[model samples]
Target: MSATLKWMWVLAVALATGCGKGATPLPTRLVPTRMPTIAPSPTSTEPGSADSGWVVAARGIEVRNLAVAGVVPDTAAPIYAVRLDPALVRLRVRYAPDTPQLLRTWVAAHHPLVAINGGFFTADNQATALIVADGEAHGASYAGFGGMLAASADGRVWIQALREEPYDPAVRLDQAIQSFPMLVYPGGVVAEISDNGQRARRTAVAMDRAGRLLIIVCPTSAFSLQALATWLASSDLEIDRALNFDGGSSSGLFVDVGDVRWQIDSFTTLPSVLLIEPRTS
Candidate 1:
């Protein structure tokens, strides 16, 4: 079989979901693949096995790596994240359903300070949940379920669980995307989630009490939704709220802040992505 076809096979197993209602149906327990070869940036202080305390990647940006506890089948998972202070940066949800590209490809096209995979999508690459790009809406919200991360015209960015707080149609949003099962709630509280017993690579979006946006990824197929939620709440990250993104082969992140640079390529191309750039006052 061709390499692309092989990755798709791996992708199917990697899209882990069992978040009750509206969760994408796919197998779980992702098989980690050899990351594409790339030389580390000169300023990149590689994260070792132990936690490399968040390092300043650039103005208003910090990067870190944490080793997650072993699950039933794996010893430890590799977690990487970048924290962005919204006051210094702005977020845009870019949708290109007709022309989805890999994370690296998107970076080459727009050169955002940071970018990561968005929410779920159908097999044909259409976004599964609501997506609003440049004030134009596509797809649909998750009803009284799931959660959304949005940026409004007033320059406000927030993460909300739909079950607790539904989307208000009246609000004008510049960027938004919905995904299943709220992870962390306000006050660093872990959202109650039913553990589905399946593990896969994971991606999530979160905001802290200070309102810094965080794009997180687990490069290994070693975590379940419940496990991830619990970890987020318990970790020192101080997450106020978070939402899960489409995972497995679909998970990826790219960053270019000063001398700090790294690209976590998704096993497959993505239909939508969250782009962050310097906030122009």
Candidate 2:
């Protein structure tokens, strides 16, 4: 059941149950490409101080590992986050539902600097929500539910909570991916999730107040949705909007950039992935 394509594809990932009302769309605009920014060499050569233990991995990328202990009652893990400046990093999506593979496989085949598991899918490798790669939409959108990490036609990238910002069909997207049960809202507010105390490995995509993208992963299933959202609200990340990607056995992340090297594989193979590459002028 191997699926091939002339170009990479993307679709949204839907939650298993209930939906929410649409709210306001996020407003993280992509900084334009003036002065040949993000290519060859960036304007600033001085790395930021290692405050908060963040390592500047590349010109516009940073990585950090946080030993979160007692952030929530009986919940903790060594949380990982890769921060990227969209002005210097390009986001792309790859789909191969019929040929599900490991995160390493996607990185090896595409040669991206970083990669992570995308949204949710069914047992048959079918997307449960919507994904728009290169203007081609596939799978059904969550509609008035969940949240989306999407780029408009002019290269503006945003993570919108559908409950606050419902999807507008008239808008053309260059790339987009959706996921269920948004965890954080604007101004660092955590969404209250109702679950029966089930926990799994967690992954999330967030936009910081500075408009930087944060790719977060909790490798251990040690925290529930409420706990994770609580930490995000209290953490120093200053997150403006955040959406939860697929969790449990589908969590994974890979990195191979300046001063950063990692390879965290998921418990199961993945049919879709989000890739990051250095933006060229």
Candidate 3:
């Protein structure tokens, strides 16, 4: 079937499912217009750096730092989590404290596509899961680049964005293909390496050794994403589903814990990030 037709069918199903009662409206938050403030850029010079990148949060959001590492590698940043075991993954549904309604409204306006479902993943012209999207970023040398989006049968999601700049078309394509196998599942643990030929930028996102849903951004890249995949394939971890999202200047990750939050941005840098922190009853 044609891609357009497939999407149409999916939308039909979503709306159809809401025909009965108990259909909550899609969250009303558009992607903010203001670029988020990203920490100073890291380099591939050190395979082991103390920098986990930046951690920024919107006001009124409470955050508790949980130390958990080893799920990926210490080469990333300081990891955080709500629980240390897979059983605690349910805390994600609790979400963080609320942000200003205006911010939520804004994100929804710019980001028109949002939903919930069993599986989520996306590539060029095709996306499975709740959302399928395209994202990009700029290199230090300054160039246009893009990446993919993938989601799992569970609610876990991953946004695979290119970390290296000065877009190298050949390397970008190679890395995207390599992303398929670079995942640590059950909680969305991922490893992203740039095509710097030296593995200068390496990042992994997962529930962490602590079971917190996280997006770890690092400064390191191998010749290909396959390098990371190869390592993960041999590990004891079992990844369920994964996806890739926009990277580079467009590469962003946001999380909120009660009144605390952390956000990584490429383009839209804000004093703090206003995100969809679900309510806890």
lDDT digits (tens) for residues 4-83 of candidate 2:
22111222112321111111121112111111112112212211212236777778888776657763344335577889
Query: In lDDT terms, which candidate is top?
Result: 1
Candidate 3's C-alpha runs over 4 A off are 1-182, 185-205, 209-211, 219-224, 227-246, 255-263, 266-276
Of models 1 and 3, which has the larger TM-score?
1
Error of 2 at 36 (Å): 37
Provide the TM-score for each candidate, comma-separated.
Answer: 0.85, 0.80, 0.32
Off by over 4 Å in 2: 1-52, 71-76
Q: Write the per-residue lDDT of candidate 3 for residues 65-152, one digit (tens) a residue.
A: 3222343343232222111122222212111112211223334433311111111112221222112112222112111222233233
Report clashes for each candidate as comma-separated counts.
0, 13, 55
Candidate 1: the clashing residue pairs are none
lDDT of 3 at 273: 19
The candidate maximizing TM-score is 1
Per-candidate Cα RMSD to the true structure, in Å, reads 6.4, 11.0, 16.3
